[model samples]
Target: MRILGLDVGDKRIGIAISDPMGWTAQGIETLKRQSKEKDLARLVELIHTYEVDTIVCGLPRNMNGTYGPKAEETRRFGDKLQEHFQIPLIYWDERLTTVSAQKTLLQGDVSRAKRKEVVDKIAAVFILQNYLDARAKS
Candidate 1:
């Protein structure tokens, strides 16, 4: 199944999509947050465009594995996604994906400004790729 992954943030929402065979993930877009209605509408368009069957949303957990306000907000966003698409929504642990993305960009010598713009999308790719790898192993 083609799966869509999301890394939600206050200012932007990073998006990724798995290949049809679910073997690879590609960074899709970084959506700037506007209104909830607009955001959901844009997501719906992506769902239809990609023919996604499942949504993998990142659940930001504290390093101690406790859900805090950020996780709660992510859950709420997932709820909205489910209500709109009525698809399977999987909450995957997103512990250090952002940090990892940043490190990768730094290693590649990406400019700080460029990293700031695309970090979220790269993080989303990491989130989806990790999930796909785990699924393949299992």
Candidate 2:
């Protein structure tokens, strides 16, 4: 099944998608947040474009396994998404996906300016890939 992954943050939201077979993940784009309505509109368009059947949202739980304010915000966003789309939504632990993405880009010698633009998307890809890997093993 086609799945969409989201790395949501205060300023931007990272987007990723899985193949129809759910074997691999691809970075889609980083969306700069303006307003909830606009964001939801764009998400709807993407969902239609990709024929997504499931959504995996990054849940930024603390390293010690406690839900912080950011995690609460993510849950609120997920609630809105679920209410709007009525799709199966899952929250996957995403402690340091962004840091991992940044390191990957740095190792590739990507410029700092460019890395800022794409880091979120890359993090989304990592989050999705990790989820796919765990699912395969189970």
Candidate 3:
């Protein structure tokens, strides 16, 4: 019951994976975007390694909960993943998740330079953990 979490952005994609029992999520790495084929190939390697059964993608929305162009782009990428992997994929509202990650890093006293390196991966962890928590609640 492993699940993969993604915080996809224009320049990079953060990656997280749940435990085999679907208990917790941990940031694995951040993939620097390249050509589409390269990016997908990299994702394929992670998916295979993790034996992911599902994908939880973060969908960035406006403050008022409106879907913006960014949201549509995310949906398209997620659709590509779902179709290619033949696995179920769901979107979790990602409003402020990156901000939350940044705050957490600040509180932890991580340097700004270091934070920039890992913020997206941490954001992926937050997104995945939130989804897991919601599933547990319901």
lDDT of every predicted structure (CA atoms): 0.95, 0.96, 0.94
Error of 3 at 92 (Å): 0.7
- lDDT tens digits by residue: candidate 1, 1-138: 689999999999999999999999999999999999999999999999999999999999999999999999999999989998999999999999999999999999999999999899999999999999999999
**Highest lDDT among the candidates is held by which one?**
2
lDDT of 2 by residue, 2-121 (tens): 999999999999999999999999999999999999999999999999999999999999989999999999999999999999999999999999999999999999999999999999
**In model 3, how large is the Cα lDDT of residue 34?**
94
lDDT of 2 at 44: 99
Candidate 1 clash pair list: none
Alpha-carbon RMSD, candidate 2: 0.6
TM per candidate comes to 0.98, 0.98, 0.97
RMSD score of candidate 3 (Å): 0.8
Between candidates 2 and 3, the one scoring higher on lDDT is 2
Stronger candidate by TM-score (2 vs 3): 2
